[model samples]
Target: MDHILVTGGAGFIGSNFVHFLVEHTDAKVTVVDKLTYAASRESIADLPADRVSLVVGDIADQPLMERLVAEHDAVVHYAAESHNDNSLADPSPFVHTNLIGTFSLLEAVRKAGTRLHHISTDEVYGDLELDDPERFTESTPYNPSSPYSSTKAGSDLLVRAWVRSFGVQATISNCSNNYGPWQHIEKFIPRQITNVIDGGRPKLYGAGQNVRDWIHADDHSSAVWTILTTGRIGETYLIGADGERNNLDVVRQILAHFGRPEDDFDHVTDRAGHDLRYAIDSTKLRTELGWSPRFGDFEKGLADTIEWYQAHEAWWRPHKDAVEASYAAKGQ
Candidate 1:
């Protein structure tokens, strides 16, 4: 593709993908973002101006989507209200962005006959048992437990239906949890890393036994590009880096990296309907597309993430107090 349109390109994962595209490919990129609180322009501001441009808009705007979609070679749909806690508090924005926004994009792509790729989350398959040996695969049944994941599941189904019923040229990828630079402090890893940076004890939810399959955002970006360029249309790919650790283990590791006692943390109320575990079996992507993660070692990747947060305090400090206050009010 010569020119690609990316929605939510200012957010953590999307920005990472945009950077990957600029460095690894020759495509000119246009970013359409609503600039929600979760997104930051600074994340992508340093990219070459001629190669990358930003358009302040929402994916749910049909006319806007059509105009942008017609001008691009392909579309990477990444905009969504993705926080589980926020979805619990209010599901309306999730519905509008994840469900209706995807619908609007699908309609535009269907009409234009443009190639499209939809980014989704593995949480749409619900949580696997902590002891379950099986991991989520492309054929896993959708059993979403929260408003955030359910809407994402609905959006994934929408893409599938459009492909089958209207012949929209599209592919889908559901990635595991992502952690890297430029992620908002509201996320789990960045929250703990920033808390420790501020000389405060990291807070854990409940006993912190929940397990998540983690992948670096950079790896996720590479995997998405592989699927976007090489994979068959109407197929779904699962992207992961085989990083699995429980919340307790992750917090302790963060403390260890800071030279603090492993037990030096507070336990808070758990989130409502939190899933137990999420593991992805990405054999298809690896074997079919020959993709591999450069950050295969979680400890090294995490240490790099910690260092990034430490060095980028100015970018995160302005919003730290408000995020902490919101969490405190919710007792989590």
Candidate 2:
């Protein structure tokens, strides 16, 4: 596609994907974002103007959706209410953004005959028992545990229905936990990294046994571009780097990097309905698309991410207090 519309392009993964597109392809990108608290213009502030332009608007606005979809050759849907804790606190935004926002894009793309790729998270499959041995693949049954994931599940089903009923040319990818540059401080890795940078102890929740399959955002971006360009329409691809580490282990590693004791961090209350683990098996994506992740070593990737936050304190410092306050109120 020569012209692409990337929803949530001001946010973490979307902005990273936009940067990936600029370095790897010739396509022009149009970003549709509402600039939510989790989004930052600085995330994509320096991208070339001729190839990338930002349009401030809500994805749920159907009129805006149609106008933007018609102008682009493809749409990459990444906007969503994605935080589990926040979703548990108030599910209304998740329902509106993850469900209704996806519906709005599907309708617009269906009418415009635009190629579409939807970005989703593996949390929709819920948690696997820590020792379950089986990882989430494309055919995993939907067993979402939180409002955030359930709404994402609803959105994924909506895309499938549209493809079957209306022949909308679209593909979907559910990725593992992403950690890299420009990630908001609200996320786990960045939160811990920034906390250490500020001389604060890392916070661990309940015994910190929860596991996340980590993938660098750059890798996630490459895989999405692969699927958008080479993937079969109406098919779903799983994106992962096979990087799995538990929360306790991850926090200890972060503390070690900052010359703090492994047991220096505080243990806070875990959220209700927190899934125990998430792991993604990306064999299908690797076999079908010949895609491989470059960040094969989790520790190395984590170090690079920590370094990014350390060097860019200006990017995260302004938001740290508010984020910590929000978490404190939740008792987590």
Question: What is the per-residue lDDT of model 1 for residues 24-61, given as tens digits with 9 covering 90 to 100?
Answer: 99999999999999999999999999999999999999
Shift of residue 18 alpha carbon in model 1, Å: 0.5
TM-score of 1: 0.99
Error of 1 at 290 (Å): 0.8
The residue pairs in collision within model 2 are none
Q: lDDT value for candidate 2?
A: 0.95
For residue 223, model 1's alpha carbon misses the true position, in angstroms, by 0.2
Models 1 onward score TM values of 0.99, 0.99
Q: Which ten residues in a row have the lowest lDDT in candidate 2?
A: 80-89
Give the per-residue lDDT digits (tens) of candidate 2, residues 243-272. Answer: 999999999999988889999898999889
